[model samples]
Every structure is written in structure tokens, then in C-alpha cells.
Target: MRVMHVLKTVSKAAPTSLHRSASKTSTRGRKSPVQRATAGAITITHADRVVYPGESITKGDVAAYYQRVMTSLLPNVVKRPLSVIRCPEGARNTCFFQKHPMGGLHHVGTIELKEEKGSLATYMYAKNASSILELVQFGAMEFHVWSTRIDRLETTDRVVFDLDPSPRVTWERIVAAARLLKVQLDELELTSFVRTSGGKGLHVVLPVNPACSWDLVKDFSHAIATRMATGQPQEFVDTASKTKRAGKIYVDYLRNTRGATSIANYSLRTRKNAPVATPLRWEELSKIEGGDAFTIRSLPRRLSRLRKDPWENIDSVKQTLSAAMKKLEVGA
Candidate 1:
């Protein structure tokens, strides 16, 4: 977690030129991959390295999966810095979190930032497919990206309502809770997209116009989450206390703030099932039974028919938190 803090601090202190640098560079800088090369390509050693046992999945296969879904998932990951869960051995063995800039990966960009405490550190951010492949070469199995890009560090592009349930809760109850929260958000005139959390929950993501600061968005998120818990006492909660959950779902709104990450859509998990974080239509929520319904093995086939990613048009729509804040302030 200390290293992750270094990157988080660096993310905030990133120079304004970093934004322009992020833009002027090629979105798909084409070149071959090298282990320590400066750019263009990457090499995946331990191609057969297994992360999930009994599944026959390999590090190389996972890289290929990311390549396959790059067109669908790149928009969400390309510009953002990742907090990686790397398992140099394998998923079942000891794994650690990474936020510090790696030294020997091609196309992987770094920003050396000064901390408020008066110290300097470097952080890493990805700009293209090769950047991801480079990380994979290091045995990264789970990738958690921040809410905004390195260029617009303070402005969140999306507000996330990460929904979690107690062990006693069922899918129907989860669906009921998600719909209830969406109705409230709808009244605020916000359009939200949903994703299977790739774990034990659902995440309602709202792409917004990036005008508000992290503080403003965090306050709004906190207020709305609290309202859902207090307003619908029987259906939802906002506390971290499990005993107080009372079988209600948690409307986790903290993902709206800075230095926090939500698993990227189409990303994979290290869990036994190799479950995937998947985007979905608003109408598909009720039909989902479990997060593992879509696993790594089944995803390749699913991709063949998905002409467009459910989130492909997300960046095209820009929303602001001002009105949503106003509506929440009025107790609407």
C-alpha cells in the first residue's frame, strides 16, 4: 500500500505538461515489444505461467485476452494509471500491490512527483496496448485503474456506485437494490451504466463532465450513498459494518474520489473461476445470477458477437455533477 500511495501522490502532482504529453503521443503507437526497450513493443516471458490452477490458463493467454478486448476496453484503461495486483509466483502464492513505476517495461510512462510532505517519487501510467502487454510481462493478474486520466488528475470522468451484498443476499435482492438506486439517480437526470464487479457485486458507473474537483464529487457521492442507506433502510446500506448490513446492499460511493480504483471492465480476476469484469446494458441487471457467469474461457466466444462494447460510447456522453448535487441537496 505504501508504493500505491507514492503513485497516488505522483498522480496529483503530475505537471500540466503531462496532460499535453498524454495527448500529443500516439494513441496506438505501433512498434515491436521488448523487455527493457523504451517503447513500441513488449515481451511476455513465462508465457505458460499459470495464475489460476486447474484452468490451464497462462500469462500469455491473459495477455492475448487483453489484446482481443483492447478495442473494447482501451478507452477506459489507456490514459489512466493502474494499481496492479502482481503475482510473480502465481495467484495462490504471495502477491503484492504495485503503484511505483517499473524500471524495465517498454511504452510504460512514468511521472516523478513531489509529495506534500516534501519528497519525490515516480508513478506509472499506461497509454496504449503495448503498455498493458508490458505490465502483463511482469505477471500482473489484476489491474485496478484510477477514476481519471493522468492529464486531468483532479477531475473524475465517472462517478461509480459500487454495490456490494452480504453473504445472505441473493441475486434477486441485489437486482432489487440496484434498480432502487438507479431510480433515485434517474430522478437526478443521470444515466448510469452497469458492470458485473468480477467478484461479489455490481457497479453502476456514470460518466460525467469533468468539471468538479475530487472533493466536490466525493461529498456528493458520500451524500447520495448515505441517503440511499437512510432513505431505503430495508434495501440498502452505506456502512462498512457487516453486522449493521441487515441483509441490505451497500451503495459504495467511495470509488468516486481520487486515489481509488475500480476494476476495469473486461479485466480478469485471480479468483478460482477466472471471472471477468463485464459491462452490461441497464436491462441486463436482473438476469445476472453470479459474477462468474462469464469466465475467461467463455469470453472469447462472447467477444465474437459483441459488435460494440457496451461501454464503447461512454466517453461520448459528458455529464456534470452540479445538478445531481443540487437534487441530492434538496432531499430529492
Candidate 2:
């Protein structure tokens, strides 16, 4: 469809109140006739690519999807620097797009140029390509949005150890790893927040001072993972190889990069379009079914009444890397 038509469609879809929380915004750019034809209900902003099973989304469609998500799933993360990328037409191996680090792939360490740009629309697509690729590998087929703002940096001094069990792994094992993580973090007096990955695993996020570099964070994560593996050999897998991780948990420390972004708490999953990663009270861990936490489709509604965000006061909490590391050594 044409891009201009898509712009008009998105304008109609724009939320009446730009001030309304999560409401849509105005479309204030000139467009070509091509943009007018294939407009959709949503507009894609800061996206690298849009993947369709048998067709490609026109520029208009891209813009529409951007607006849709901004109006729908992205208000919280939107405050961060933003970009978008669209997937090409007739693409089959979504996994191939995801694993590749070049172009729009999302494996990690992919870069896109925004300042040296052509059209603003084109730049948005280029910047978000890599992130879109990663989300697609996780069963996402739509436009993937991204933010590059350094201000999004929340924890710098704190260390996070992500415990992810392989698919088909038992929930009991996942919980056991979580229990152990709580003990470990508590002993160090490093407050932590635990949330489901929206898939099979759990992410235990800790807020820390931002003084340390990524290398230190990596070291701390590795040390904790090693300790946890030694203490619970059967339940936690410490190997760096995929083949050796069978019947065990994997400790993922890659989320410590400077621009790294996790799917936000209470964010939506575009594939199932369901709510995923709902925040939980630590007490609810044992009560709810393993996968009952939340998904994309249900999160916005839930956030209306949520009084506290898990990471709300993360910045104010004072804890040093030295103290945290020492606590780890004593298993305090």
C-alpha cells in the first residue's frame, strides 16, 4: 500500500490526547504517494525491518505500525532514544535474520548510523534493524523498536545474573535456581527484582551504581554464576556451550552492555500479541502457575493500577561493587 495513505490512517489512529498516558501522537511529515496507499492501523518508529510472510510493508505501513505500537506497547520505553527498522519481503528463515550480527540482526553488537541520514523515516528503520532481528528469533514477526538513550541506563554498580533454563526444562528447577539466587543476592545485601522472561526462564535483575564498566559487571556475573553452579550442580548449568547445557540452567550475563535493553517489565509480545513479563511480588512466586505471570496483551490494563515499579527507586539505593563482591566471597 502507499505510504501517504498509511500516514493518514495513522493520523486518524492518533490518540486524541497527546498528554493521555500511552495515547497516540500526531503525524507531521510530508509523504510520497506510495506512503498513502498501504497505510495500516499502526506506524513503526525506530524499526529496522518489518517482516511479512508473503509481502513487504510499504513505507506507509511501516509508519502506521510505528504509531500503533507507540500508542499500544511502547510508552514506557519510548522516552529513550528511538529508531525503527522494517524486514524485507518474502523472507523465510526468521532465525537466519536473528542470528546474524550484520545488517538488521539482533544477536548483539550490531550498529546502525542515524546522524548521517537520508530521510528521517529511512534512518529510523536502519537503526532498529538489529534489535528487530533478535525479537523475531524469539517468534516476533513485526517491526521491532529500539532506544539508544544513555539515560535508560539504570544499574551500573549492581551485578545481574540471569538464570534461564532451556525449553522443556522443569519449572521446579527454575524455581530452585531462583531460590538460590535470592539467597545469594540477599547475603550480599543487593536488592534484586525477579521477573519471568515471558518464555521459560526467569531474570533476576539487581540495581547497582553505574560507576563500574561493563567488564566489571561481566566479571561479577561470572563469579556469581560459578558460585551458584558449584553450590547447586544439578539444577544450575555453568557451561558456556549450548550442547553441554542439557537438563540444566544457563547463566546469561550478556545484558550488561552499554546499550543493552531487556523487554520491559509489563511489556507486550507482538507475536502472540499477549502480555509478557508482569512484575510480581516475591511472595507470588510459589503461588502462581509457572507460566502464569503475564504476557503482552494483558500488561497495559494491569499497569493502570500498579502503584510501584520494581526498579522505581533503583537509583537511590546505595551499594558498592567492592562490598557486593566481598559479600559474594563470604556467601554473606
Candidate 3:
């Protein structure tokens, strides 16, 4: 049997941890180009099943798409506990969130979580192309990963500015607000990465050193957000109330919590057009009219024509909140 019962041994003294094997053919050191492209490790049970009835995209197609993009997508997810949204029948069928045990799946990475309820739960991780493809076989339609890695649960490596616009806000205004946030981040000398939220907004992320707790990060994020909102009241808000969000975008900094997860880069989203969460250059942000501008149908071509990954240096860059916090003159 290919399915492995991924057991996470946890205790009061130990934080949640998993014994991960990236693939069935696990070996020490780095994986090669050839290893990443192999889909042979994963078995797709419903190869011909149409998962996207309107677009006629089959289960096999989704699996293959994941395989092709797996190499580019792994860094953002590897070692990070994930929240998977599965549509077992199709996009048209009832779907639910899968967060624990991973049921019985092939080559899926596992991690234990310190739940708020004072217990441990086994969550899934994607360690290799085989594992990513395995989830596709299990009907995973969307993947969301914690910003913090499993090895360092208390420390977060990135901060996200989720610019959630109100229903009444125009797309143009949303773009403008995103540009505003980017410029402010730039002024602080922190490199910012902007991406479509795969919904009606944009997310601006900055890679930071994981030397602080979730509470401190959350506080720093709030300071930055409130400062921006205070300065540009017409353009933004710091809360989620629809009434307060009138004609403004809400800067959601709450995703910095201990267990909150965001959609992984290059992951598919729940939408009629099947839009993929895309990384963007600051210049590209101005031209985008909607979040769905780049869908699964178009991203492969975009990746092929690109000279290099826009977020290529993200993981390598070492940044800290101290400078940005000082620049904003805000305290944690």
C-alpha cells in the first residue's frame, strides 16, 4: 500500500512536529531537475474524472499542472503546515476544509499543530512534487500555508498586508490603494512583493527575520496598517466592518496570527475562471484590472515566457521589522 499512516508524536513539552519524507524515493541533500518533473511517484485514481465541468478540466489535468509547477511552488510551502480545500466531486460539488490526519493519502507530508483548544492535530504539508500531485488525486482544489515554518512555529518569516476592498470600491481604486501601500513600504527600505489575493483585492508581503513572536509581529503589522489608514482615511480602513469600509479598502493584518494561513503562491483558487494566486512586480500591479486577470489557463504561458521568477530573491533576502518600525515611528 502506498498510503502511509503519518504519525505525529506530541507531548506537553514538545511543540507539534512531523517526521517528513518528501517522496517515496527519499534521499539526503538537494533534488535534481529530473526528480522534480517526475509525476510517476503519485498515482491519480480518477485520471479521467472532470473536476471542472464548465471548463472540462480533468483530475489528470490538475495533477499534471501541479507537477509542472511543483518545482516553482515548493519553497513557499515546504515545511509549512497547510489548509487544503477539497472539492471531491468537482467545483460544482460540496467542498470542505481538510486540516488533520490527511485521512489516507500517498506521500503527503504531515505536521502536528498546537491547537487553541489545548490539544494537538496532525496537519498535512507538501514536501515534493509527488506530495503535491498526491493531494490533487485526493481532490485538493486550493492550498493555503502558514507563513511560519514548522521548524520555527513561534517565529514568523513574513508579514502580509491583505488589502481587502469593499464591494462598492472600484477595481481602479483597489489598485491605487495597493500602490499606496507599496510606496509606503518602499519608503521604509523594506522590499515589498505584491500579489493578487485571488479574490477582489491584493496582498503585499515583505520577507522578515523570524526572531519575534506572533503577538509582536501582529502588533507591528497593526502599527503599519493603522498609520497608513490614518494618513489615507479616504483610501483605507483598519477594520472589517462593512459600514466602516465604505469606499475604502480594509488592511487585514490579522493573518499574522500563530496559525493563520494564506493561499500559497501559484496555487489555484475557488473562482469561475480558476485563477491562480500570482506574484507580481510593482509595475504590473498598476495594469491589472481584476484579480482574475491571470487564470490557470494563462499562467503556464506567463511562466514559460518569463526570464526569471519575480520573487526569486525572496527567501534569500534578510529583513527585519526594526528598521521599518522605526521608519514608521510605530512601536510594537
Per-residue lDDT of 1-332 in model 2, one digit per residue for the tens? 31110110010333321111132344765432321222222223323243332344222333333333333344333333322211333123322222112343332333233232332212222223233323333333333223233343333544455677877678877877887888877877777767776667677877666566666677777788888777777766667687868878988776555434455444433322232555566766786566435633245445556676645665577665677777676763
Residue pairs of candidate 1 with colliding backbone atoms: 32-41, 33-41, 33-42, 34-41, 209-319
Question: Candidate 3: worst 10 consecutive residues by lDDT?
Answer: 11-20
Model 1 Cα lDDT, one tens digit per residue, 148-253:
8888876788888888988888888777777877887788888888888888888888888877688887888888889988887887888878888868788888
Candidate 1 regions off by >4 Å? Answer: 1-40, 113-120
TM, every model: 0.84, 0.59, 0.84
Find the 10 residues in a row with the least total lDDT in model 2.
2-11
Estimate the Cα RMSD of every predicted model relative to the unseen true structure. Answer: 9.4, 10.9, 10.0
lDDT of 2: 0.48
- Greater lDDT among 1 and 3 belongs to 3
Identify the superior model by lDDT, candidate 1 or candidate 2: 1
